[model samples]
Target: MMAGPRPNALSWLGLSAVLVAVDQWSKWLAVSRLEYGNPVPFIDGFWNWTLVHNYGAAFSFLSSAGGWQRWFFTALAIVISTGLVVWLARTPRSDWRSALPFALIIAGAIGNVIDRIRYGYVVDFVDWYVGTWHWPAFNVADSAIVVGAALLVVLSFKSPDTTGKGG
Candidate 1:
């Protein structure tokens, strides 16, 4: 006897679309309203809005490697986003743990790819700091990617119950 047809998580793409819209809108607003390199304090000492352009990967990796990094990162993001979409297609609809993260990552990857293709760099604006130390400036896309990747890591440890009795 074959198992019944299982629904897939492709519907989760809706969430991806919403997140991508938000990421792009926030980037646009930042580019329109924020001054480059000038920080506008949000929380006095902990957060600020500072516009910056990233020509490389996370933490501005390979940012100074001249001009080739732009296309490289763009292509890389496209490939990764494609893979995540395929994975989501194969995942069970009930598995929100996997589906949610996959959707988040897809949104983030596509959002940044749009920036790279249009501007040759990703727009970053949010800045967080404490005292003299500060985290690298980033945007909504980066936040989604980080949160999605972190969810993947944390969820990986949750093992499904093998016993007939559902836990």
Candidate 2:
């Protein structure tokens, strides 16, 4: 096996930086260009740009719990981000399956944390619906988080062994 520092590694966190920048830029654009509580259809029957603020986690789980969820989520994101940093540092560059998901998670968690700190809530804009069954509005950060989680699930199934060896 070839040795001496794996090539094109993610330890530098370049992709994480890009994801975070793109997420924050998109959110900024949404806030600047879109009207709150208004649904601007991007597709006839699939998607739309509906701006909304979420005060809690996925699907606004604790959105109704006064305003304390803000700090709670912020702290949680920080902790998660810290863990991701450690994972990224320890992860081998060749482990794209793990590294990509970890970077994505870091981008998403930190992106949402920024919103929580700046506005006390997350700025959600992407909206999808089918007839009256509408999905909750979410932003790029949410998308990254979901995709990263899905990728992690797929990786788990792809390699049933928990050990990072014997491939």
Clashing pairs in 1: none
**How do the residues 38-154 of candidate 2 rate in per-residue lDDT, one tens digit apiece?**
999999698999889999999998999999999999999899889888877777676788888888888899999999999999999999999988999888889888998899988
lDDT of 2 at 30: 93
| Clash number for candidate 2 | 0
Model 1: CA > 4 A from native: 1-5, 161-167
Q: Which candidate comes out best when scored by TM-score? A: 1
For candidate 1, lDDT tens digit of each residue in 1-167? 99987889999999999999999999999999998999999999999999999999999999999989999999999999999989988997778879989999999999999999999999999999999998999999999999999999998899744453543
Instruction: Write down the worst ten-residue block by lDDT for model 2.
Output: 3-12
**Most accurate candidate by lDDT:** 1
